[model samples]
Target: MPSDLLAPALPTAQLPAHLVASSTRYVETGLRGAANTVRAYAGDWKRFTSWCALHRLESLPAPVEALAGFLTELADAGKKVATIQRHAAAIAKAHALAGHDSPTADKKVKVLLKGIAREKKTRIKQAAAFTLASFKRTIRSIDVSTPTGLRNRALLLLGFTGAFRRSELEALNIEDLAFDEEGLVVSLDKSKTNQLGQAEEKAIFYSPDPALCPIRSLQAWLRVLDRTEGCVFVSLRKHQHLTTRRMTTKYINLIVQQYLGAPYTAHSLRASFVTVSKLHGADDSKVMNQTKHKTSAMIRRYTRLDNVRQHNAAKELGL
Candidate 1:
């Protein structure tokens, strides 16, 4: 086995009895949430600790006023409201774990939650999405003969077909992709819902049309890359084997920017999928199921009015 393929051994450490019990409960109750959420929480806590140390605070068991002061400092430093809220949540969770009732928890939660609501309202102010014709034109503008073009085509197709978020696209592995006579099946262990709502594991299948240009391009790229053993996508290296190194969300964003120009991103592919699917008369329920969305409210954001209007206009004019 390659050195990179070897799984690292678990570390030996004396953990608190409550921590051990918490781990056991998480495993037994099947409440082991997304690893990304846990990592984010850990990062937020570390930032809080750093802030506390800078202020010469002895312990996190400090008064609620201290936490509020820290938040004020963050605000004064020009941190976004969302970032401040994340910091507050992290500090509250840590205080709760330490058997201290956080004095600022409720206030911080309210402020942060309001900021989130406002952000959603801001997104609603943006113009509606483009039509299928525009989307097709965008894809046709790319030259699919080169290796980078081939990879971008596959990335765009899979992202649109799966309605995948940037993180979900990055986490995809070769073993997770299953090809059948019907079409392609993508099994994802983690997604935005898993990270945010802590829901059950779910996967989505994309049945690409044989005649579709993007699908054909993806099929050709797969054959040329010959990466059937590991991750479906990889860096532009000559190695045939898939190493443990995985693509990051940052890389996916960079790829999208390089190929499609500004304002278009990995997320735009997902938006295009939802917009196009809805324009074709796909019901809200069916679209939600394919997108693996838990709620119609969340799915509605993808189905924009401009897409529907353009599609209807085309049909009415027989264009």
Candidate 2:
């Protein structure tokens, strides 16, 4: 029997100082924020370093001019402004930690940063949310009578219901799921934000509607799955169990493309949760808890209030 595919859970030990410091000096002391934020910043900073190296930049501690030039190059390459800004923020933090102020703070660097920020703001479009209709369309397109179909249905529902990111879905293990009277408890060992704030390990519980619950699909998967003791989701080849390696994030992307046709990613499921929750009057704090968002401002972006309010107002006007 192929062992279940699941990434080994990362221990809750503090990460190496050098590894963290490579991204930012703050990591030397420790990340005092969200785990997801830290990981993103780390990745962004590394990419900036790689870009700097490719351009033969004299130093990792280059001036704001170099940073500005890089941002321009990214924009010219057609990267979204938001993505470019994220790179800028990550590089800026690393530079600042290395005893340099933001190049933007310099009169010359300031001008370039301002230009990029303004230009990018106009170009960045907010992401769209996944609606119930969209979800149904994607699932209905799948032929769920087969094992692969069963796995895909369970995967889609779990992704939506748990608001799971691609990486999180891939890391899921059968042991992580626990059922109680309240609902299901999803024990995520490592997430985008796993190492943020105190760096302690914690599990998030997911409570889905019982009638149209994703867990029911998960249960159906468990019944037919060969290796029930390992990862919750596995790849099937001709109804034969393949390696028990957990599904990759890229596979999740491919799955999204197959079902939704395009312009949708795993993160959209998380955003969808926030959008729908807000539309249904879920409080900011409650939604934040579900989405694991640190701030209200970030949550506001996910909740498309203007559209919801407009639709509600039209109904009242009719009454």
Candidate 3:
């Protein structure tokens, strides 16, 4: 029996193992755009397929009413509105991949989602901005002498200054870093925004303070790694044996949580970069340059709280 555990979970019951492996790679790399996205979509799709299988319903050629029923069931089961919506999108994508129009486009499914949204009053809970004061406190708190401390410090500094997504930080390797007279340049050939694999260069300028400088921190961490290749952030074993294995992005979140407690995500570093920059009066273009945001809307989303306070018309009004 062919393993259904592989991604794409397509038919290959009688096929050779090599052929199945090749097909899975094609589906993962070609059919799917990014690894993280593929994983999320696959999981969502799996939920749908499982539900369908349990009910003895046709999954691939699923009826519009069946999708509506699925949403109803999910809502009844108290799933988050956002999660249900993501599953719906996954179903749509799956249908598209299979060369069929998604039933999610039907007015029945659309109306059901709108009703659920209205009832739930759901909102995406964003990670709290890791403020500058908090940044300073974290630096003072964390021991920077050890190899692990240096690595963590470097990760936090670069993650904030680069405004890097968790995946972007995890995907980084020592070779991706380049230094020059100016400062350091961290190259990201492909990001969540630029999945075409186009090389995008984000410059990290030298900070006045030696403690907060990303370049210096990175250099300190590199001295510990002492290798020309492999991931920049790796699992540290005894004797500083940095494994070639890459650290999961979730590690970023746990590190922050260790310092700040609950309600902070790995994205807090990136969000902090935007909020701090905005508070310092940096313009949209400068912020976007580092963040690599395609539109002003996304940058605005990250800086929304600061924008409201900084640009308040009530400040000019007389009492």
Candidate 4:
């Protein structure tokens, strides 16, 4: 929750004790609880409150008609359907927090959202996959002589082969990585999906080409840094010493965007892993093991473009 949201509008003594406690605890908690989710929810709330302020409307315990007006405003502005949906969710969550009945379920609001969805024709935008050739070229281009380059190379390789999300990669520590003759093992204590902290392990075996091997890249980086514990990927300046401070998703995004194209973000590496593997006939189950995707539905979305006629089941039919 944003600090303003958490800050009591009125003194605690002015409101009921139960309301104060509920607003403090659950108002900012969001639909599904995660660090990233909570942060996004806070942003959504900020936008909603700002809109309300502009219209001279009370955001807390917002009325159903006013909520519908908000949706209409968003639709008129040509906001994406997904964005409008999130706005509704933020309003609902805010009402819930203030111990008031939410207007999200009202018939008018539902109709407004349905109309917006039909008009916007919004579909989820899958990150463009980094082609295998492109991936190889990107890796080759990295000047590993510099400390910064070495870290970027190791980060890119591990993130790609392991099919790790930006948060997962940033969360990794030296202790999370273990190497052997076969490959490397990374233990993730928590992830967006694995909220219970049930440890998950991802394996990245050696590639035939040492230059392309993620394991070798990581091993080389480890040798240079020579750290027993701390973040596996630390920020390094050009010719400057390494800092133990953990890296953020911004750095990861910056690295990919700079080396590859601006369209390719940090997620492109992970999506590319699934796409490249599936394109060559890797089984869905095996791919899920690396990607840690609980369902095959999302995996199919990532690899949809590769599932063409040549790779389709009908190709085997003697038609």
lDDT of candidate 4 over 178-243, digit per residue (tens)? 888888899999988887689899999999988888998888898888989888888875556887
The candidate that achieves the highest lDDT relative to the unseen native structure: 3
Q: What are the Cα lDDT values of the candidates?
A: 0.62, 0.66, 0.83, 0.81
Model 2: lDDT to the true structure: 0.66
Candidate 3 per-residue C-alpha lDDT over 1-319 given as tens digits, one digit per residue, 9 for 90 to 100: 0123235655888878889978766664555557787778888888888888988887886898778878899999999988899889888878766646789999888999999989999886677886688788887677887888898888888888899999998999888999998999989989987887988988998888888888998999998888998789887789766676788988777987877678787898899899889878899899999999988889989874634565576877988
Model 3, backbone clash pairs (residues 3+ apart or across chains), number: 0
126 Cα displacement, candidate 1 (Å): 8.8
Candidate 1 lDDT over 1-319, as tens digits, reads: 1112112222215767657656544432232235554567677777766777888874356566567667777766766666777677666655555546665556764674465546544233332345556656666666766766677778876676677888887777767766655556666675766544443332334435433444466677677767666666666655334344666777887887675666676777777777888768888887786678868887677766653445565657765
Least accurate stretch of 10 residues (summed lDDT) in model 3?
1-10
Cα lDDT tens digits for candidate 2, 1-319: 0011111223225767555434443433342244445567777777776777888884345766677778788878877767877777666555544445566456776676567767766645754577777787677677777777778888887877676777778878887777765557776665656554232222334435433457677787888865547877777666456557677777887887677767777667777777777777788888766666789988887765445453375766765
Ranking by TM-score: 3, 4, 2, 1
Best by TM-score: 3
Q: Report the alpha-carbon TM-score of model 1 versus the true structure.
A: 0.71
Residue runs of model 2 more than 4 Å from their true location after superposition: 1-26, 29-57, 96-107, 194-211, 226-229, 238-240, 305-311, 317-319
Poorest lDDT segment (10 consecutive residues) of candidate 4: 2-11
Which pairs clash in model 4? none
What is the lDDT, from 0 to 100, of the residue 115 in candidate 1? 55
Candidate 4 to truth, TM: 0.85
Give me the overall lDDT of model 1: 0.62
Off by over 4 Å in 3: 1-31, 238-241, 304-311, 316-319
* Superior candidate under lDDT, 2 versus 4: 4
